[model samples]
Target: MTDAILRMRGITKSFPAVKALQDVNLEVARGEIHAICGENGAGKSTLMKVLSGVHPYGDYSGEIEFDGEPCRFSGIRDSERRGIVIIHQELALSPYLSIAENIYLGNERRGRFGLIDWNRTNADAAALLERVGLRENPVTPAMDLGVGKQQLVEIAKALSKEVRLLILDEPTAALNDADSRHLLDLLRGLRADGITCVIISHKLNEIRSIADSTTILRDGRTIETLDMHGDGVSEDRIISGMVGRELGHRYPERVHDVGAEVFRIEDWTVHSPTQRDRVVVDGAALTLRRGEVVGLAGLMGAGRTELAMSVFGRSWGARIGGRVFKNGEEIRIRTVGDAIAHGLAYATEDRKTYGLNLIESITRNVSAAGLGKLAKAGWVNDNREYEVAERFRREMNIKAPSVLAPAGELSGGNQQKVVLSKWMFTDADVLILDEPTRGIDVGAKYEIYSIINTLAEQGRAVLVISSELPELIGICDRVYAMAAGRITGEVSRADATPERLMQYMTQTEEASP
Candidate 1:
């Protein structure tokens, strides 16, 4: 602690209705990879924001010391000048701008005349991309790259600044396993280069592998900092500090009583919406039984989202060929309205974009999908809407001051709850949830799992698509694996394992003839 490169003491920040951070303390040693662990709304992000000047000096009462000098930063630029840079969980990049342009956006490279030097900018960007292990062209548009590569671009942007202390907020939350590994390796290399790093992540295994020490926070207060190499510092131990209780089981236990098949998709084939010649889903078939929680497992680009979107009223692809069956009766569903009319609901993975309206009030968002049920003569019953939203808010345990609050005001976990409540309000017989627990803490994930169990217990069919294998094995009664746009295999819960599911997920040939 004496050789700490950065120290924050007695940090307290508050908003209108809530006090976010309360006397939080943090210390990061020079060139060590330190991690911050906490549940959602636990003040981890707020503390980092306060340090990086997103909250500014006067907004929070705290003493910040960087490199043994007391500092008061009024803005993000002020912190950047002091060699501190932060990359938020939701990446901030201009999608239309080229990689070089995005990297040198505010910190532009200039020539003798103080005009932008395009040649130098691109060359420098290319070098930084290489340093981050991104083999992308500097002139390529930011939108052309996937989430993983975009993360690397964000890091390259940080490197553009002469950053001494790097702070990453859930950098690997959206990445696949391979991409997550590559980013972690890059962080290790950066640590070796004597650049201190503070990473906020929910992935405990990654923290154990990369971080030198970890600080746990709960309810806006610092719990404790533990040495990662200590004799008994395990993931469960970290969870204990984060949630303030011994988390006996990561997943809640559920009774499985799967019933008759209620929904089925047969001979499903979908071509890419942009690329007509490319097949995104080929002859994919799946079934959902009443009172069952089924899982769809796949790697990135394996067409899990594509299949779900396409089946939900052809919202994704073209040249779609599929037959929908409900109780042995073939039905036609060619639009979202039609799908909803047929008792189907889809909770998207990108909740910010596709699920709930951020600017809309919580009551409105909850009643949006089920307006017809609360409508009379094409006018929504505002009183009924409020009643329904309050019911869901209490049932789902969404933390908010009031149902009139905007959906955007809630944290990630609360926002996800709103999304689920939106779909649940529709009384759909079958629900397709894509990455339901993405970017949420372990405690929130358990709550989501319990909600899914409650849904199944109510005799609703549920299809869960996720990138995490353990999640599928833990809560699902049966799982289907996809690879190369084809269903490779299906396994019952009793027979499912990460290794076995991985074998099925990596297969190139279709499981079905």
Candidate 2:
């Protein structure tokens, strides 16, 4: 422990009905990229909150030693003063504000008259941006940048704080392959400069690639810490430590009994909502059979989402021309309600923003899409609503104290289950699940896959959109590759491979033409 920069001894935190952490201990070296791996709700984030003062010194039982000095932080500002910064999974930056303004938001440069010093702030932000490999102007609005660039801006903001022990919570969960690599490389650069970093992520491959050492947490307890280089740790070993069992198969076994075509789209064309002249989805067609789980595989901007949204009551596109068929009969879905009435439900990719009402309770969110069912002659029965939500909560195995808990308080997996409960309550025959298992742990992913299997077994037509090819291959009976708003190729489950999917995903327009 002589060279350890951060030491967390016997940390224990509890909420109203749950013990989030128990006797958690962590030691981070001075300049190493240490990783914290665990399933969702395993108390990894809770530990970091305690360290960063989000939980405060008195709220938790822990002894924290930084640079061999015992420290008790009462608030985030107190931790920041000692160069301890934590960047959360959801970024904290105002979209309308300029990059420079956001970087110096709380700690501003004041002039002689106690006025903001704009020139120095811009110059400082520019330097920090260059260090983080973001080339955008300091005066540019944060909304103008992409998700990857915005991540860099967040890192630059931490750099402005002179952060020594930087902590990142699932930083690459939303980034693409290229951006993820860049961010990992940037972490290496930070380590080279003698800054210690602690990263929490579910992506094991990334942890294997960059992490010098890894700490595994399971059920709010520290399982073990392994030196990645010294022990030559494999992914399977890490999985066993995380899940507490040997996972023989990456995906659960499924018996496919595909039925006749139940849903089909023909000559679907969608124009960009903002740029009406630009075509987003052009002449796209696909079919989903009853008792089938189909996948839409594509790159980040391949219009898979556009195609799904455009077909679902024209919710996304401006000028949409599509012919949707249900049970071999043409249907007109001009609105979300029309789509729901026509036996269709779409679980959006962004659950926090579009899927679930964060401030609302789980019961309310689960019953949101099927409120009409609880109504009797325009009057909702409170007893029936509670019973219905309770049934779904029990069926979904949502981990919460009660069905009335706020959706925002639940972890990513529970929030996803709530979203699923909402759609399942709608009882739609055709379900479009976009990024169903994104930002969730492996255990939660298995549960979600089981749910998908149940839906398929019930003869529901399910279409999944995923950036992770392995997930698509594991769950889907057939996979359709989309590129430039068009279906490039379709492959059966027996012949799908990551390489084959990538070939179709990146197929050139000229070749298709």
Candidate 3:
């Protein structure tokens, strides 16, 4: 018998208009950690669905082999019975349920009285949670845990079914640096326990550290699966395989002369809504100049987001006390609408909730911010709206079926483009893009960088907030590091290495001697 644990041959999936997957093949050896590397909307998730039976047979043309025998998975349950479990990127867990209950939800230990045996369930859950490096009490509600802990709980839940093959899709995308490292360590432990693992992520650093082999996908086809355990494997080799071409530069070139200050903050402070005495943003003063992309760098909870939102209007925090100036003149921004009217637009980091109306069509979303301008006598000019949206659709290169496509149906990267287009239509001179490339793929990220550069060249003052230091270093002329609710230190792009930026980022005002 072959040593392969899972094999997918000639998988093909098509939608009404687009062929999502085209003749893809993959093989995972027993007890090996494999990674799926691809750009956004490159059929990586679709291939995973086919492997896990989410697509099922007849929906796609594919032959799947498990343990050297032919198998057919009609649904998620069918795949689960064979020890195949997949944990999605957006975690799926009951918030109200206790950790123990969530872990043993569907499969429970029932007594003679037809009631669940809580003792047995907790005992089993505790053991599994320990294996996943989660020490939280089993009785604690799942909602009380952070995203990292919740992800570990999901892993425990998957292991409760005694899974042999585990699939994780972008597991660390929502996690912080420490949590991401802990999760990767847990994956290594699972592999040592003889469980074969498959991970799909755009984070090449983590893949280089932990994966034994990686499969590269381009467009709708599998490029190749290179062995990382061998001597010839490297990130450059993997990147070439995934992109199908050599990259001359990782980041686009930036050339823009900084002009006079366009916007400024003086003695800004914000009190948390829940805790009145607690200050989230304290005396944070900064400035943005014309034709400049200034980077805001900080560890989580350093008030980077709070400062942006507070200045953009009273979009965040309570008891806001600040002085904002535009072109050296004071501006009254009491509401978000006022901020927009004053040539300011904020793009949130959490795009799904704060950045967009997901249920609306892309055309409506793009025109939502500019409706007043497009309206004539309290009636929207349909022809004008269509023309405006069509122009942006072409400019942004939004890969959608149509402008009338629901934003929810679009991919992560495309949705982001639409968000940018929304603000672009408003003709805002000062743009606050909070984590603009948070969840996008590499190719899309390059496009975003180019767009930012173009905006700067056009004399728009761009304020970019990013957690990824390398990103800020690449694009911004200057970067400010925040710590403990204040701007700590500013660095030039040439001097903005990860080490120097992180040192300023983690430093606090109340540090010990």
- Candidate 1's C-alpha runs over 4 A off are none
lDDT by residue for model 1 over 1-513, one digit each (tens)?
Answer: 369999999999999989999999999999999999999999999999999999988999989999999999999999999999999998999999999999999999999889999999999999999999999999999999999999999999999999999999999999999999999999999999999999999999999999999999999999999989889999999999999999899999988988999999998999998999999998999999999999999989999999999999899999999799987799999999999999999999999998989999999999988899999999988999999999999999999999999999898889999999999998998999999999999999999999999999999999999999999999999999999899899999999999999998999998641
Candidate 3 per-residue lDDT, tens place, 257-351, comes to 88999999888999998899999988887789999999999987899998999888789999999899999999999999999999999999998
Q: Which is superior by lDDT, 1 or 2?
A: 1
Which 10-residue window of candidate 3 scores lowest in summed lDDT?
Answer: 504-513
Question: Which candidate has the top score in lDDT?
Answer: 1
**For residue 271, what is the lDDT in candidate 1?**
99
TM-score of each: 0.99, 0.97, 0.97
Per-structure clash totals for the candidates: 0, 0, 0
Residue 211 of model 1: what lDDT?
A: 96
Model 2, 1-513: lDDT tens digits are 348999999999999889999999999988999999999999999999999999999899979999999999999999999999999998999999999999999999889899999999999999999999988999999999888989999999999999999999999999989899999999999999999999999999999999989999999999999999976598889988999998887788887989999999999999998999998887888999999999999998899999988778888998899799999999999999999999999999999999999999988998899999999899888888888889988898999888888999998998999999899999998999999999998888888998999999999999999999999999999999988888888989999999999999997461341
Q: What is the model-wide C-alpha lDDT for candidate 2? A: 0.92
User: Which residue pairs collide in model 3, if any?
Assistant: none
Between candidates 2 and 3, name the one with more favorable lDDT: 2
